[model samples]
Every structure is written in C-alpha cells, then in structure tokens.
Target: MELHRNRGALVLPLVCVLGGAALLLFARDGAVLHRIVGGGGVLLGGVVLAGLLRPFRFAIGADGLTVRLPKLRRLIRWPEIDALALDQPPAEQGRPASPRLLLVPAPGVDLGLPATGHHPRDGRAAVELLDLDRVREKPAEIAAALTRHGGDRFVDVLGLRQAAFDTSDFTVGLRGYQPDRVDALIRRGQDALVWGGTLERQAARSEIERTRAEGLPVAGRGYNTTQVDAALARLSGALTGDPSTDRRPTT
Candidate 1:
C-alpha cells in the first residue's frame, strides 16, 4: 500500500508553469517579454521541484518498504531494515503535531535511503536506512503498518504511544501502574531505539511478551484499568501485529 500526503498543493505550481509557458510563447514587447520569461523560469523551477517531490512518499508492499526521497527512490527488502521506529518532532506547546517514520540502519548493511536528495554521501557518518516522508496519518497508524509487514526483522523502538513516551510522565500517579516495573519495561523498549544487538532485541521482545501474557499490577487507586489496558494493547499491536483480541473494542 502506498501512503501519500495530500497532493492538493501541487496544483498551484502546475498552474504557474502552464501560465508562464503561455506568456513565454506569445508576449512580444521587449521589456514585458523579459519580465515574463524571468517569472516563467522561476515558476518552471517550482514546477520541477514539485514534480520531483511528488514521489516523496511511503510505498509498502508484500516485498518490502520503498521510501521515495525528493530525488531518489529506494527499495529496501524486509531483512535489510535494522529497526523501524516512529518520532514526532517536538512542536510548539499548542501547535499541531507532525510525526515522522524513522528507520535505523543495520549494523553494517545499508538500505539505500539517502540523507539528501541532492548530495551523494549526505555528509553524515552514520548509516541511513529510510525515512518515510509526508505521512498524513496518525503516527500510531504508520507504526502499526510497519509492524504488520516488517516480520521478525522489525522492532518497535518507540514503544506503544510514541507521542506520549517519556521518562517523567510514567512516574507514579495517584492511580497508576507500578512505577518501577513500568520504568523497566520502558528502558527495555528504549534499548532498541537504534537497533541494539541480539540481547537487546531479545529483551525488547521479552517485554512485549510479558506485557501481553501477564497484565501489570495496579497500586491503590492505580491507573484506570481501561485506559492502561487499551494503551498496552495498542502497543502490542504495533509490536506484534496481534493486538489482544479481548482488549480490543468492538462496534
């Protein structure tokens, strides 16, 4: 499935290029013609940029993940990915949120997602896997899709609620999960943030298994059962692609 951001903005650039072409062909006045040509060149540049950028999207299919950069499109098979995680760049306090799908490169292998469309090396020493641009869906949704398709190679580095994943927030609430236990699980999830070795990966899977098998303990006036359980189930789905059947809400 191809996940694309809305393409409505492309229309303005298309119109500019078309209108500029018309003026370039017909305008006869010397001074007027110069200005028209200049404007048309600028518009044409925008048109090219928009056209090239139109391919910047996520293409997930049975074979693997294809992340199309502004100038390059990379097709990475499932095994090539080291870790698949999601991040929402922090925004102004009350502004709208923008979430990005981040891919961590494997130990020594490269999956072909380049840092910059213009530069060859991208000037970064670190290995780059892929970054899915222009994701208009909820970050959770994208994460879920990756988990479902990524098979055994994929690891959820961001845990369940990436937008809400943090150290401080999970601290002891009047009515919430055990702080110590939850913290340990969060730490395990963080270990996979950048595709740790086998032990780290095993630990991440272990936490998911434990969370799925045995529910967390609740202290006096602990976190709301429904809320906490629902959150965990969502995380479970994003991690295992087998969300708790009992926990899911039905129509």
Candidate 2:
C-alpha cells in the first residue's frame, strides 16, 4: 500500500518559501548573506515539498511486510515487528484523542528505526506513530489484502479489539474480524435497500445509531457486534418459530 500525507507535508514549506521570498525582496538586509540564506531556504523548501508528493509504502514482501520511506531510504521489516500496539490513554493521562501505531522489535529482529533513532524513519529524528496515516479508514480493505497475499502470517483479524490496548508495545488492531464482519453486515443491509426492503434497511440503520449513542467502539461503518448478535439471535428464533427464544420486541 502506497500512501502520502500530501496535504499536511506541503502547507508549511509553501508558506515558508513565499514568506522567505517576500522577506528577501523587502528586507533592509537584502545583502549577499540574505540572498544566500534565502537560496538555502528555497532549496530546503523544495526538498520538503518533494517528500510530501512522494509515496510512502507499506508492502508485504518476500521477507516480510516492509514499510518504505522513499524520502529517507529506510525500510521496516515485519520480522523486526516486536509489538504492534496502540495508545489511546485517557486524556487525563496526557494522551491525545486519536490512537497511534508503535513498532516494537521482536526478540532477535533488529529494526533499523531505533538504532537510527528514527523507527520507520521518514527524515524525522524520532519514531512516532503519527507517521502511519489513514489506518482506521480502510480496515476491511487492508484485512482482505493481507489475507490474499500474505498467507495469514499477518496479525489475526479476529483479535483486534483486545490488541488495540497495549501501552509499551506497538499494537496493530483491526486485523481482527470486528471491523470486517461488521462492515459486511452493514453492506448487506444496504444491498437490501435496492430490493425495496426499506424496513430491513431501517433496522440496520437503527442498530448503527444505537451503538454509537451507547458509546461502544464501532469497528467499521455500520458494523456493531452487539447489534449484529442481537439481530441474528432474533432472526434465528423467528425462523424456528420459537417465540420464547426471540429477544426482539413484538410490534
């Protein structure tokens, strides 16, 4: 997977170049030193701009999953993956709102990130989780891709909920079925909409809204485990004609 944080990395450099040029033209100290400094600023600005346009990669290769930072010429291998953890510590603990992805090394696997003082270094001095972006955006797509190419060697897709909570280690969640299955259920309901099953679609919609209102973690769009299980139980009971077994209310 090749991704780029195009918007984020370009804004500052553009502003700096424009500002520097303006300063060079109007400043009283527009001497040789100022020209030289302005030239250097322009060069650095181009470099930063190029880095933003370039694609960053997350590829599953013959050796393992490699995260490539083309700008930095660095590759992080999966065997070096120690712990795939997430951090959403309470804000009171001084943690940020969104979670981050951390890369922990395995027992013997030597990831070049720590030694280089930049895990998955993309020209940054420190290894930070914010480097990997759009993680939660396409969990199901990522899960399916991993299964197709990586031969199930990647993290288990079903255990993502529990895996999302590690502190010290890097935890990779959404590999679990929570997101994938829930997404499937939601799409199924949406598909029903085409067949004029409006009531069934509404049921799915209500399930989604209720879950969000309840403050339960939703894995993917319209994929709430609690709602799915409850709906499934009700459907099965209905098919069996066992009214006693049905948990849904009678209308």
Candidate 3:
C-alpha cells in the first residue's frame, strides 16, 4: 500500500497563509477587534502551517500499517489485524466525505486504546479503527492501493452507512446531541414511572441478545454498547408504545 495525505493538510496552509497576511497587512488601519483578530491570526498561522507541513500520515506496507502521529509514528503488524474496512467515496456525487480505515484485531493484540477491541460491525473486541478524512481527489487510486496492500475485504463505510443516512440529518444540533446517552434518560424515566422498569429492562435485554447473536461482545458498564442499545430501546418503546397507529414500533 501507499502513503496517503489528507486533503485538508494542503488547504489549511493556504488559508493560514492568506489569512495571516491579510490580517497583518490591515492591522494598522484596523480597530481593536481587528488587532486582536490579527494577533490570533498570527498564532493560528504558525499552528496551521505546522500541521500542514507535518500532518497525520498513514502508510500501508506488506508488513503492516503505520501512522505518523503528531508526536511520533506508530507501526502495526499484519498478524495483529483481524478485520479491515475502507470508506470509499460516492461515484460522481456531491462532495466526498473523508475515507476511513478500520483495523480489527484478534483478541489480546493490545491496540493501546482502552476500549474493547471488537470490530465495529461485530462489536466483539474493542477494536481500534483508524479514521482518515478529507481526501477525495484520488479515491480510486487510494482504494486500489489499500485493497492491494491492506487486503481485499473491507466494509465500505462510505457507501453503506453514509449513503443510508441523510446528510441533512447531521445538523449542528444533531452533532451536539449525544445519541448514546439516551439510556440514562430512559432509566430516569423508568424510575419516574413514565415507563415500567420491566419493559425497559426487556428492551435492554433484547438489545443485549441481538448484539450477542451478532457475535458482539457483551457491553460492560459505562458507555458500553449494551447500555447505549438498551437506552435506545427504552426511549424507542416510550416514544411508540402503540404501534398499530404509531407505525414505528416502540423499543
């Protein structure tokens, strides 16, 4: 596989350069706000330039994968890799979302992250998936290289999940909203008798069962998959108790 750079790395520098120059040049005739903005611009320019010059880079090789982090570079071996996925861009569509590469390892590989190493699909191990965004100009080339080097099988995250979800749904409000925490609210609601605890627990159990059936590992305490799913189910159930008219089944 080849090394690929983020598209933002290039554009960020140009912005820094142009913006900093404009601010510095106009500082004399500027107000207090302009001076403050110019000072911030200078600092931002330095930072942006550094990032642009030394961005987070990844390399695909016959041996394994390598990431050039800001502090230092990390190398991963092939045997450590369990599942690999790539998010390819849309075919001749609107702006492309940045691609991602996920690497799920066999148990006990120690991906260095605290979470369980399950692949996102199976959710078995707390898998550490690497995300790469902002590169769309050479998608096919990147995909081909990744396929050739990283292996052929990859969950096409871009085409599958992204296409399925409406872009409009991802608004500022949604971004700020945490969907995972719906469980706590549901639990609170259950305690308040807004919904029965048994029903909420049943929903959680259903989720736990479904995840287990899919080979996903049991969700542990605190931000665990089970908690999130259970919460969602509880909320769903509360929202649509009467399915005949609701059409949307309650969790």
Name the candidate that leads on TM-score.
Answer: 3
Question: Which residue runs does candidate 2 get wrong by more than 4 Å?
Answer: 28-55, 60-63, 70-77, 88-99, 115-130, 133-251
Minimum summed lDDT over a 10-residue window in model 3 is located at: 165-174
* Model 3 lDDT, full chain set: 0.49
Q: Candidate 2: lDDT of 158?
A: 25
Judged by whole-model lDDT over C-alpha atoms, candidate 2 comes out at: 0.44
Higher-ranked by lDDT: 1 or 3: 1
Give lDDT per model, in order.
0.52, 0.44, 0.49
Q: TM-score of every model? A: 0.42, 0.38, 0.49
Per-residue lDDT over 1-251 for candidate 1, one digit per residue giving the tens place of the 0 to 100 score: 67766555456667777666666666667868656675876577686656646656567777788866664577777666655545433333322234445555556765544532211112123333333334456545665777678754444444433332343343335666654455456545543433344455456767867875787876653444555555555443434322222232110
Judged by whole-model lDDT over C-alpha atoms, candidate 1 comes out at 0.52
Q: Better model by lDDT, 1 or 2?
A: 1
**Residue 168's lDDT in candidate 3:** 24
Q: Per-residue CA lDDT of candidate 2, range 10-100, in tens?
A: 7788876776686677656538777767777777787777766666556544554556565334455555554343222222221223334
Candidate 1's displacement at residue 172, Å, is 35
- Put down candidate 3 lDDT per residue, 120-237, tens digits, no spaces: 3444444334445544335455556656666744454433333322122212221232323332333333322322345544564455445435633222222344445554454445
**Cα lDDT, model 3, residue 94:** 22
**Model 1, stretches more than 4 Å misplaced?**
19-50, 53-57, 61-63, 67-75, 90-98, 112-138, 151-251
The per-residue C-alpha lDDT of model 3 at residue 147 equals 63
Per-residue error for 202 in candidate 3, Å, reads 21
